[model samples]
Target chain A: MDTQPFYVAALDGLFGSFPTDADSLWVMLIGSLVGASCALVGSFLILRRLSMLGDAISHAVLPGIVIAFLLTGSRNIFPMLIGAGALGLLTAFLTDSLHRYGKLQSDASIGVTFTWLFAVGVILISRFAGQVDLDTDCVLYGEIIFAPLDVLIIGDNEYGPRAVWMLGGVTLANLLFVVFGYKQLKVCAFDPELAASLGIKVSLWHYLLMGAVSMTTVGAFESVGAILVVAMLVVPPNIAYLLTDRLGLMIALAVFFGILSAVLGYWVAYWLDASVAGAMATVSGLLFVLVALFSPTHGVIARVVAQRRLGSSTIEFADSAPS
Target chain B: MNESSDLPPWLEFFTFSNVNVTFVFLGCVLLGMSTGVLGCFAFLRKRSLLGDALAHAALPGVCAAFLLTGTKNPLIILGGAMVSCWMGALSVELIVRYTRCKEDSALGMVLSVFFGVGIVLLTYIQRTGEAAQAGLDKFLFGQAAALVDRDVWTLGILSVLILVVVAIAYKEFKLFSFDPEFAAGIGLPVRLIEIILATLIVVAVGIGLQAVGVVLMAAMLVTPAAGARYWTERLGVMLVAAGSFGALSGGLGAYISYLSPKMPTGPWMVVAATILFVISFTFAPRRGVLPRVLRHFRFRRRTAEENVLRTLYLLGEPLGQWNDSFSTNELLQYRSMPTAQLAHTLNRLIHKALVKEPAQGRYALTDFGVTRAARVTRLHRLWELYLTRKLEIAPDHVHDDAEEIEHILTPELELRLEALLEHPDEDPHASRIPGRFVPGESGG
Candidate 1:
């Protein structure tokens, strides 16, 4: 009864049975949204040399989310957002202060602050497991496969999965922030002293950027988990950084890389029956490796080839000069 | 409730009568010591997060080891972790050296990518429907309770082997950490020493994976060394102290986990290490916050008193009457200090017999105070003249520098400045430079 061609069926199988239904589509949509938003904010992080801060904020937000859950007895979005933003700011503040006043090195300060907060988060989750819905394993890798089950119901009308709506909102907010504060963010990332001299509140912009990272992280938490959020927050931007020089192009390319990773990662997970978030992160990482090795301007191969070419040309010039 | 009810009495827990507890405790101790020692070098080299990347990168290796052997043997899995993490470290080094990416970006890339691969492999393994795969999940956050005696023995031996390597290459590692270029210039095989050090760290991290897990193991490596740094300045002492702190925290974590069935050993151990860090950060004798703050306050108080004395001496300079006692109001005219603060400074000086109230609301310098004021004013003027004459600094810009330097300059520094400035009799402002205080001098 099937009228489809053999190549189409084979392609479908190759894409892990493509022509995906509503559930798979929602999963991919959410993955792309998470990837895009993280990449949008991550471009600034990479430029600012604060890529590791993204990792720190993602891990440190755990206790804030759990405390918000325990207090409200619900996974309401607003409270969780506020809690995560506050904790992200706290992580930045603590790391800065420890480096400045405690006479500790920058990496050591970051390592101490995030690890302590994360440990507390783990302990709180385990101690209050009976009272809250989160568990250690879910906190680590997440359970994005079951995301579609929690649909949003509004006045007897059933919408799609709640993650799509939340992630969409986060993506839109991130886009708006980037669009409006693009110049200020660029100035601050390239040179904070210049931004300050230009009357921009550098610390305020830093916190605002951190707030965006926190919001993106919290929105992606349920679907991808904390560690994978870190991956999305840094990997795409890293890849884009290697491929281009212009900030605008870098942002655009990072989003493209992020979406590519999400789509490919979803299919990889579907085919291999592995964690979807994990596969996405792996894909993003692979893309980074590819760019690092083969990008036209910044790639390792190109640099080596250029060096060799220059060496041979210099030798030829010397050979001719002897005549 | 069932788990807690099954636990032995509190005394039995402390006594370590259980063989499982004994093995776990010993294993954690060794893990702590090796990580602490190796972490010192990592921290000194500014490669703290490299340990983190290595730890995250080890997860895939662990899963690969499990898949290849179809076994959960700690030794076998750890060996796999070591190989993969070493590769990850090498990759990071290459990326930083050969590409435009900085160390931080390279580290973030390797850490997340390798961890993602591990997570993927782990998920696949979890779905394989094998009973032996049950314990493999423990490596994510660590399950010290699940470690057997054989696992303990393996970890202990590997940890000791790492320590021995560190001890054998101590001086070379020290040189490599402090100044790699100098070591290389001296023909010390700097690259080999660095590779050896990196391998030792990988081994230390590899053995610790079973007790602290891949996620939190960096804390074990970094926290103990950071804490130990607060207590000692010598590398030898720091190494010993860091090892002890590591062992104590490890043992304490094991004991606490035994007491509370719900508490996982890894996080508890981290909590313990953090507590020690907090203690060292706050209460250590020299580098701690408390002592530093106290010393700062003491210096501030001293500076205030000396400023008041100098102000009184300057107020009498126009009249050329060093012995005349000046009222607080007259003294206030020369300095912009608050009335309340002036009174407090005068009170402290009176207690020290540096100044006295010859009349109500009037202050006068004592014989000893005259010499002290002369010394302070001499140093201030000497620095001002030095700055203007030698450094070609503007007169207006030299006062602020002299104000701070006057309080901190040692006697030897004053002699050097005096010689350098050829014992100038006047400052850049044309004010007479007071001579160095002589104890037997009159009130001239």
Candidate 2:
């Protein structure tokens, strides 16, 4: 029986009574992998200064999935995802094009595009209630509460949350892409104009990066939900930004932070018996705000503490060490 | 309204279908006027997006007002929206002024943290699930249809008051926007003026939250200013144009949304403003694509004519010669076929005696052509020298642009460049400087 928080399932009852220890193990394992992937993808988005773009994409992808269902006439995961992916690409293209050729400001383009897409989606759902079921209950928070139901059934009893598998696949693909083109992506991210002068096709890199973001978002949405995915994508990378100067380290720290948020979010959600996605997103946002205000390099509290430490250390070192 | 054409009978906007609809349009016009006027100053100051952050900041105030009054009076909510928006504005100003964070970071920080708090409060309210909490969530995504006539009247009056304040302070706002340092030097109360400007922004944003919502209200403020910028450089013209654009968009959006029932008017207004920017970007006379293309086409024609004259001059013909001007087909045989259009261009030149068909197959340079060609070549070599010496252009970088510029150099600019380069006779590779045949300066 699971008689502990998933992380402490190896011991005994810690926070909650689990009927099965294996269930808690599954939760921890799945949550960590999902968190790691969200964090890794989030790093580049934050660094590229498209952190809010993640927020927009997550919302816009909703209508895509809905449209996909209308076309494919089924709720199978893959077709629904493909439809969402296409919509995500369209939103990114429109947003980018508006900022470029349309001469609209980046924020306004983002603001208008996502809201329009969302409104259209909402209107469609209201108008075509019989055709689709994009219930607010399911889309906003996700069915992570029901994630364990759709296990890939083998012969007998070999079951797990279907979401974990989808997110795992996405996470691996994202890792492979970043690893293969880390150098090119880094240069392009830092300075697009200079990268162009060096003969890098900056536009191609932009589409590729946007594609990766879209994929990660859809996968994360399945695992957590659209709202939580944004928090997962935006918060960890932002926290990592506070921690380090190096991109690689920032990415690594972001993943670490992401896992922490996921584990915390799960317990919080369980404790409150509320929407897991909402709790996860809330917890993730709190982590970021805390890091923004208190991380060592630039945090307010860190600065004050560092100053006090410096004052005492200087006096001690001056008496003991040679100048 | 024409919008009624697109709607079902129950929702069709008759004049009396709802007086609230008229109020929405009027309120939008007043908001448009104030924001357009205020936005001109913000746009000039490159702080157009500050309204965006301030708009987001209003969310907390909205939540706080909910917590305090337990009343749904639009007035109480707006008061709260103003307070939170100003607090957010102040936080941003503090971060920028007192800390090392750049504008983007400070803006991002204030926007996210404030909104996060609002979201948490909103979620808390939802979780509490009081029946009244139903409308509480509407603040995130606004409901313009829910607005009552009284609500619209309040917004309308507030907007008018802001419009009056802006009109009266137009000169003061203009002075600070264009040159705050100058205004301060002249003792114009720059800080107080900025504070007033900030307060005006908070008011416009608060009024807009009821009609359009918060996340996008900034577009109402900034888009008109940005679109107007493409049309005019004069401050007065830009302000008027922006106000006019805002008014039209507001009325159109309000009428359409009123008829359609489900469409959000504020976003539609932003879309309309974006269309205006698109029009201006392509059509503005001074920097437009059409004018630039026309300039380029004319320059090409002029340059091709000069090239024909230089070729005849080089071939030692006082009359324009056919050395460079074979038939149109012969001229088309060049490596880059694009250059062959120069023959059609050269034919235009022949009519001017810059080139002439002295024989059936040949063209010769006139006396005027001979001097102009020599002068073009002289200017070409002189510029190469100046680049390699004074500007320190690499030895290899000088040839490409000079090949294009030489044929188009005006006599006046050529004289000035020659003096700037101290009358150099040799290019980077020791080419000859074309001596100026300046009418009186020929003696010098």
Cα lDDT tens digits for candidate 2, A190-225:
888898998989889889888988888877676555
Local distance difference test scores for all models: 0.84, 0.69
The 10-residue segment of model 2 chain A with minimum total lDDT is: A11-20
Error in Å for residue B140 of model 1: 2.5
Cα displacement (Å) at residue B266, model 1 = 2.1
Q: For candidate 2, lDDT tens digit of each residue in B345-442?
A: 66787777666665686555555665667777677777787778888999789977887888767778887888898877667876445567631122
Q: Each model's TM-score?
A: 0.91, 0.78
Q: CA shift at B127, candidate 1, in angstroms?
A: 4.2
- Chain A of model 2, TM-score against the native? 0.84
- Alpha-carbon deviation at A101 in model 1, angstroms: 1.4
* Candidate 2 displacement at residue B204 in angstroms: 3.3
lDDT of 1 by residue, A238-273 (tens): 888898989999999999999999888888898889
